[model samples]
Target: MALLSHDAGGKPVRAASGANATLYCNESTAGLSMLHKELAQLDERVQRLIAAYRQARLERKRALQERDRLLALNAELKRRIEGVVERIRLLESDQAQ
Candidate 1:
């Protein structure tokens, strides 16, 4: 059993659930439509942001892989330099002898 009431314009408005509450046709309907539109726009914006975030994550992953590869190459180069220095020291010691 829904109760019916009238707005200020004397138009019979449907009342919401509860006692003595009248729904303003213009305000409620228009506001809801506007809110729905804004929500849809916000949803689309969120989807785009999510896609961008995923792309950034993929880029970050590739960058990390490249960094790891470079670090390994640096370590290998450092080891070779150390070996060359040891060989030079050994040769100089032999010459001194």
Candidate 2:
């Protein structure tokens, strides 16, 4: 049978037989160490994901800015072409007259 009691911290503590207690303690410690390692790995993965998200957002913003600049350049080119066409039309009319 096991002894059950509350420690000073109000947490229930278990008292076990000597050999069994030793085996259980070792296993618990190993399990806790494994849990800590797994948590550390998860933390690393989360950090990497956050970094990737930030990089993607920055790339998207840069692409948007590039698109806007290209659009403005296209509009400017169109306006210049229209002005040239108007000048050519006027010159052709003067020649015809």
Candidate 3:
């Protein structure tokens, strides 16, 4: 007798295939049912954790991209400000001549 049976979605459950099937008591069946429930719950939690990890990875990538953009922008602004300050110094020197 096969020790397992599958549902439509191919999930396995303990089963007895032959005449001795009724030998399993209600308590054992209940225990098996509880174990299956706990396993399913764990599976769900693991999936949720995996999804959260992926989201965090994407957020990190986005943050890095934003940081690169801001760094470039800051460099450009500093260069422009320095040029403006040099021009002001040159103008002030020329005015004093």
RMSD of each: 7.5, 4.3, 5.7
How accurate locally, in lDDT, is each candidate?
A: 0.82, 0.88, 0.83
- Which should have the higher lDDT, number 1 or number 3? 3
Candidate 1 segments exceeding 4 Å error: 1-26
Worst 10 residues of 3 by lDDT: 17-26
**Greater-TM-score candidate between 2 and 3:** 2
lDDT of 2 by residue, 2-97 (tens): 644456699876757888887767776797799899999999999999999999999999999999999999999999999999999999999999
Ranking by lDDT: 2, 3, 1
So what's the TM-score on candidate 1?
0.67
Clashes of each: 0, 0, 0
TM for every model, in the order presented, reads 0.67, 0.83, 0.74
Instruction: Write model 1 residue lDDT over 1-97, tens digit each, in one string.
Output: 3434456799866655544343454466777799899999999999999999999999999999999999999999999999999999999999999
Top model by lDDT, which number? 2
lDDT of 1 at 13: 60
* Residue runs of model 3 more than 4 Å from their true location after superposition: 1-24
Which tens-of-lDDT digit does each residue in 9-64 have in candidate 3? 98865656455465543545786899899999999999999999999999999999
